[model samples]
Target: MNEQDVYDAIVTRRSTRNYKPTPVEPQKLARIIDAGRYAPSGGNSQTNRFFVVQKQEIIADLIKLVEEAFSKMDVYDGMYRSLRNSILRSKEGGYLFCYNAPVLVVVANKKDYGNNMADCAVAIENMMVEANALDLGSCWINQLRWLNEEPTLLEYMRKLGLPEDERVYGAAIFGYPATEDGKPNRVPLPRTGVDVVYL
Candidate 1:
């Protein structure tokens, strides 16, 4: 992709929270993951481990565990609005965090590393842009990272190849858009808080 293409992709990337029950092409998935792997790491540590999951069974199992975990928690004042919603929705039964996207990419890194989360965030953003370029809808899934330290979740994650010393820092769900036009909503919103300073 050229510079303009990259810029266009970034401009059009939007948070897609809904997806159809369709699988992504294997080669496109590989390209998205490759974009993540090429993301810059702090000091080039390259410690981020990307777990790409496409199996619906595994995704369903994870969703069940996530709902159960959220259901056990109490919503507190000042908590993130989305998390509070997750808890309430889980209690009502049927809470799919990834919006049923066919591809779930969880980025994990050493828990103690100062730049672990930062690196993971970069990788996720890279893949999100790549997904946009490929005309796929993508959304950031933060619930998993929020529950990274929960004992039950940790154990299950370990069984899925998450190292004992590692924890999820970020994740992204990607697949074809479920919209009628089959394209992600790309109209940019006004920049409100990202203030700029002139040197």
Candidate 2:
């Protein structure tokens, strides 16, 4: 692997919603997941599960199931903004949550684990940074986690080998960017809202 600044990769890793049909190389994808597997876990649980889905049919089915599940939901006041948006968009039709990325990595952890979400978040962050370093466009996908508890989704995921005691906490889609130059959009978006007051 060519040397790329880790801090640079972390800072420039933009969420790439639009992707080319090109798939990530098998080796690079392996490395991406490896990066996640190395993330620290609560009690060193190391219980995170990764479902690397590249099959078109499986991804298509997942999209359909997610849209179907979201379309039936009602948005409520104080609801998580993204979840509400997913529901509204699903109701309107044609919601491809993964942005047509050629590869999707679904992250799951023990449902009863107190640090499930935190562990999953760190894992996703590692994968995203690794993808950025490997020149793959990646985005954190939350829809799957939102639907993790839905019966239909749970059943379908189990059919795909998800253990009965675990639930999806996060997912990510990675592929070549659709940008004209075929590189991740590295334009810096200055962070303005993460307030920091040093003590």
- Candidate 2 lDDT over 139-164, as tens digits, reads 99999999999999999999999999
Instruction: State how far residue 144 of model 1 sits from its true place (Å).
Output: 0.5
lDDT value, residue 178 of candidate 1: 92
lDDT (Cα, tens digit) per residue for candidate 1, span 1-199: 4899989999889999888878999999999999999999999999999999998888898899999999999999999899999999999999989998999999999999999999999999999999999999999999999899988888988999999999999999999989998888787787889898999
Best by lDDT: 2
**Candidate 1 backbone collisions, by pair:** none
Candidate 2 Cα lDDT to native: 0.95
lDDT scores in order:
0.93, 0.95
